[model samples]
Target: QIAQESEPGLAVYALAAQADMYRWRGDHAQARAVLSKARQLAEEKGLDFEQRGLLPVAEGITLAESGEVKAGLRLLSDGVRFLEQRRAKRELARARFLLAKAHLLAGDKPQAVGELRRALDLAEEIGTHQFAVVEGQHAVGLLKLGIAQGVAPCRALAEKVQQLGGLGAAEVRTGEGAEEGAASRLEIYALGEGRVVRDGHTVSSSEWRTAIVKELFFYILLHGPLERDAIGVVFWPDVSAKKMADSFHTTLYRMRRALGGDVVVVEGGQYRLGDVDYWFDVEEFEALVERARLLPPHAWQAEDLWRRAVALYRGDFLPEVQRVWCVPKREALREMYLEALVGMGRCHEARREFEGAVGWYRRALEVDELREDIHRRIMHCHAQAGRRSEALAQYHRCREILKRELDIEPSVETKGLYERMAGKGPD
Candidate 1:
């Protein structure tokens, strides 16, 4: 900004630097706005290639964040080579940081971690630990992915993240990064029956001080940070305001006691579950499904990703919760689970393993038997496997379910498929 007045040419570099700062802070719209100014200025001034290279790396990181992983990778990879040619370790550190974001977005956890390690080393070598600290979310997120992938967390990196403050900051500052061990790490299994486990021990019913306390734990975990008044309404709107206050505080205290004092973080008049390096099953389950979406739909990696996702699903999300707010969440998650199952089935069908394909499609139907598409797929599988009688049986069953449950006849597609198959008889 200062260079814009005294030296407009240098403003291009200033804008690139500003764009990166915005990207690190997750203000991508602002970052792009900055990048646009930089590009315009560079073009108007007829800047050299070296002067414009910084813009691509910054733009590539934003592009990656916007889900254009392939295009982003091309630019960022070019950025990496550009920095390497110059042997600009500091700029290369920034490129690694940028590339790490792209790689993580591309679902390449190992490569993301490798980029992060180099970024950290380069930052340290260049005495930019403060810069690393400012981009703490990137550090913490990649570190968690590494841990999930069986890579150990580096204490040195964790310290820089602590300086930037967030959930893991407390643990690192307390010098309990590793020494606290996995035993203290809570795993909230909200996907199915909603259980909490720690240290290989399932927290018993007695562990929760009261029923509301357990309910509120899920509320915080799922809904994220919420205001006290808003939460009071959700959990105890029926009671008098004074009574609601008493009950809310009581439940909050019990929650803290049962789940550790630092587990609940209060900030900006909102409460959020924090301070611990805990795993929420819902997050991992959703992440796997999303990562699968990033890959080619029919790729083996996508298939395997769905398999892992569905395995963690266990059942519908928080089935016991009857809150109105949870209903849509449960329905949405069930849809994702169904998608994974159907994806697996299609993968099998693509391989001409009709038997296995039918099995997976059947599982999907079991989750929600009203799925006409799954029913049709099963029929296709049967016909593919030359099991005409079973194919006919599936059609009859689909007809009955649609009739009884939805009070509707089979669609034209279903009817047409059955007609064609019946006319052919056995293959």
Candidate 2:
């Protein structure tokens, strides 16, 4: 309409709008084309800010949605800088929201949550509903925060999303979602080099069959080596002991065949993963957490290491494996995983990555809200970052939770942290 009416300014707006529509429809190519045209038109009209800010923002969204996430993030960051210089808060919010979405898609939950919170604040300030966008971002952010902070809000957000009938609805109810979608034809990962096979042809697939063997492989990869007896007891608990052993052997045989002979080896009657250069998400997660823990105290790389680790923990290990025996191990590993996440958030806090640290801490609390140490850490992170009111509020929340759930008082450590924040001696 703008083009037909010869309204060049409106034409730019129209192009941007069209790009967004295409992006929402998942037609990233069309979005990119529209954004490119908008960029050329903005330059032709000598609209410096629009050329630098609007064009790159649109381009970044298109690129990220199209799976070129790193490139898209770079472009969006540049665009955000330009918008910031112009004091364009609304545009900046939109850019940040888009960047957050890109990060979430790339499995960088901490970064995504930070950006989402920033966008939320901006959106609220502008009085824009942005409910759809904000809600989705908040849902994912809350879930990640829950994993790090041991808080209930993350799960609550997830539940809210399901109540509203969202993509994660099933996940909220069952605590399991569909595995990550198959990689697109052009998809590639930097960590591992291999072609995904589909129908006996390498067409760039990502569908790993979620059989019992595959789940066991993932479990071993995450928790590291398990005895054959323990594995059978956990996964095949309903079957008789003799039958379970046979099942284990059969499963292992099939897994070896599917994953290739060299992927797993039995040693001393315990199954262990073999020498494989390929990256499994769970293995990457453990390595990242270990690296973060090994980092010197107050090191800047600690947060980065933790971020990488948390990103790989997409969900609970073998979420569908729901036998009673499996629950203990799964929950135990989840608790340990949450602790590692809390450690990462503390690292981020030491580096003054306040929002990032908050994200991590929140995720930990989501996993286990009863951990007093995490509550204290969150309070300290908030206070040290100059969010004193939020810090105090966190203390109050801890007090309330302790009172309501455990019928106990805050620990000396937690009280001490809060007292210091209040400029008083520990109670």
Candidate 3:
């Protein structure tokens, strides 16, 4: 009360923060009241745009989560445009994240994906994590997406986010509560073959009529609801425009018929896998990883998550359906797999279980034997277990791989580790 009386300017921000806290805790009525009071206080204090502009964005997201999509979106869009006009680079990431999450809660995953991509781009453009760790859900989603899209910077940031224990607020699930109750009728596996099991029956490749039809369906299910133009370019880049359009409609129609009328849906100008009783292995695998990521670093649960994640990978993503687009996603998931293996090793090492750590490191090397760091870890683990001979042998293997694969010598650190492990140099 004293601070409010002495500094109403500060009081406005405090009130705004209080309102946001209420909103996150499912207290919409209290959030609205506090937000209104904050806005009123801002106005009474004659706060300028810098001090008060984002209040509307925050308020819009709050209302949207409370069953007012259009009204909230209108205000949110206006606020975003205001930020755009001022070129508020950093703030745009947070604003767009809020916008994307609102779309997610509104049952617009396609647009949510688009908005999430934009937010990640904005963060990338500024060369910052952009407070992504705090944005847990969207930021981590982008990290996973960006890696699949082969956006190199996302890897570094994603690693930081994972190590720090992923961050985010509770999801706003309105229609999704109903979705969660539906019995999953479709089992779509993209990890190995692009396999589909529909209505308790496996869909054979010959059932698609056209060779590309099943592939098209798999593409949409895994990476869409994509724009028609975007889909056309990926599938039929050289075909005439009219032919591409015809093939697209035909494929889309077959996708819906074979999957179901409501499966492949068009909404908000994008073709999406609608609210269906479906399960994708990729989603499950990523979910396991994310749940583990949410735990504290070196916590016991993370290694267990890696075990499930490794078991679920089966093989490279969509290997039977060879498409240009599948490569990055395959690599991205493989990258995550490698990281998980290393994570397991780190967890074991943290517990002073050196031999077990070496085992996980070897598994990572099996995936990509050229990883110098994993080799170093193996050496360190062996040395810790008082196995100087094994440590020396692993170093030689690392040096040979470097020479054979990339034709480069080991880094100074790697050599130093080997020397220290062999007790042939200063510890």
Candidate 4:
């Protein structure tokens, strides 16, 4: 009442919050009445945007609570879209969360899960710029409900939200170890081969009950946290959403059971593996490369960092996993590995260690045989070492590889190197 007496906007916000509480308690009539009053007040004050934007969300939740699922969902969707168009991300996230609630009330578990995931993602995104622990708490609640109802992925999501909320609202930040803020006790190797080592002990693959469970575990590791729907699309592409959801839950259960409860943490709709401290080889590799980048280009320490980073790539990333999703990540990691090799080569070249530089350049070619730039470097290294014939031969290999693979000749850069080695300037 005091809010209403003071600022009309404050009263509107307060009324909306109250209506939300009423809806949560299942007092649909009271929620609707309160929201209607709020709407009326906003309308009287010409608060069209607030009335048009936020009131619909409140009324939608009220309608959903009253068992008007279809009508409620429609209004919620429209209201969310309206706010989305207006770039009101916080309001959109809130509306989506409410829509998930409506889906649950409507007995559409799959849809509810999907909507909840979207809400959580949106909330996490918003939390990056603004603090919103309330959204994290709501995600935790919904995930708990999912667990109670026997949805497998929720267990991990609940843990993730708890962690995000625990480390303050900002912890929901994605990418580059947001959940695993500090170094972790769990060490996983997905580069070359896939392995999960706890402490110092390597977990045997034989212990994984099913291949799908193992695949699911690595998939989450590679992609960080994932939503149930996304897991469905990737792992069970041919199955219906309902069937895939069931299969995904079953696999997730197996994942929790096999790896331990804290192995994977699901935040809202995504599954991640960072309840405790954990380490992934690929992540470490990337981190090492990133650290080297911070040093001066010719810094001597970079040689060691690049060597250590390049050495970590035992083979192609997750070669055992034949999923198409792994391809891009594998390619990306391979490129990073090759770049590390190039960095090491450059470091050696700077020191005039021609043999060592040639070794690194040749190793780079083994990974990416089509690198004309590396070929050029190798030729330079041979020429510097007084291996004039070997230098000329290296240029020949470059020309042949380019011709056969790309059906194109070597770049003018390579031809110029050969001409310089032969004591003939370009015409």
> Candidate 1: lDDT over CA atoms?
0.73
lDDT tens per residue, model 1, 92-200: 8878877875676555667877887787778778887555545555445555444444433345556656555743655444434222122367878988788887656
Best by lDDT: 1
**Tens-place lDDT digits, model 4, residues 197-289:** 765667675656577788888888767777778778888899788567546655664454345445665566577865566777888899999
Candidate 2 deviant stretches above 4 angstroms: 1-210, 216-253, 261-277, 324-329, 353-356, 385-387, 423-427
Where does candidate 2 have its weakest 10-residue lDDT segment? Answer: 182-191
Q: Each model's C-alpha lDDT?
A: 0.73, 0.64, 0.71, 0.72
Clash statistics: count for each candidate: 0, 18, 3, 8
Estimate, for each residue in 1-427, the C-alpha lDDT of model 3 and write its tens digit. Answer: 6656788767876887787777644456677778788777677767765343577787887766554556677777777888888889787787887787666545555676677678778988988764565554323444444454454555566566666665222211111112211224888887766778876778775556566878887788777878888999999999998667656765654454355444665667687777777888899988888787776547878878878888888888888767788788889988888877888888899899998898889989999998899999998888789888999999999999999889999999999988877777898
Clashing pairs in 1: none
Which pairs in model 3 have colliding backbones?
Answer: 136-167, 225-271, 225-272
Better of 1 and 3 by lDDT: 1
Error of 1 at 411 (Å): 0.8
What's the TM-score of each model vs. the native?
A: 0.56, 0.43, 0.56, 0.56
How do the candidates rank by TM-score, highest first?
A: 4, 1, 3, 2
Model 1, residue 334: C-alpha shift (Å): 1.4
Question: lDDT tens string, model 2, 272-310?
Answer: 766554544544666777777787647878767766766
Candidate closer to the true structure by lDDT (higher is better), 1 or 4? 1
For model 3, the run of ten residues with the poorest summed lDDT: 172-181
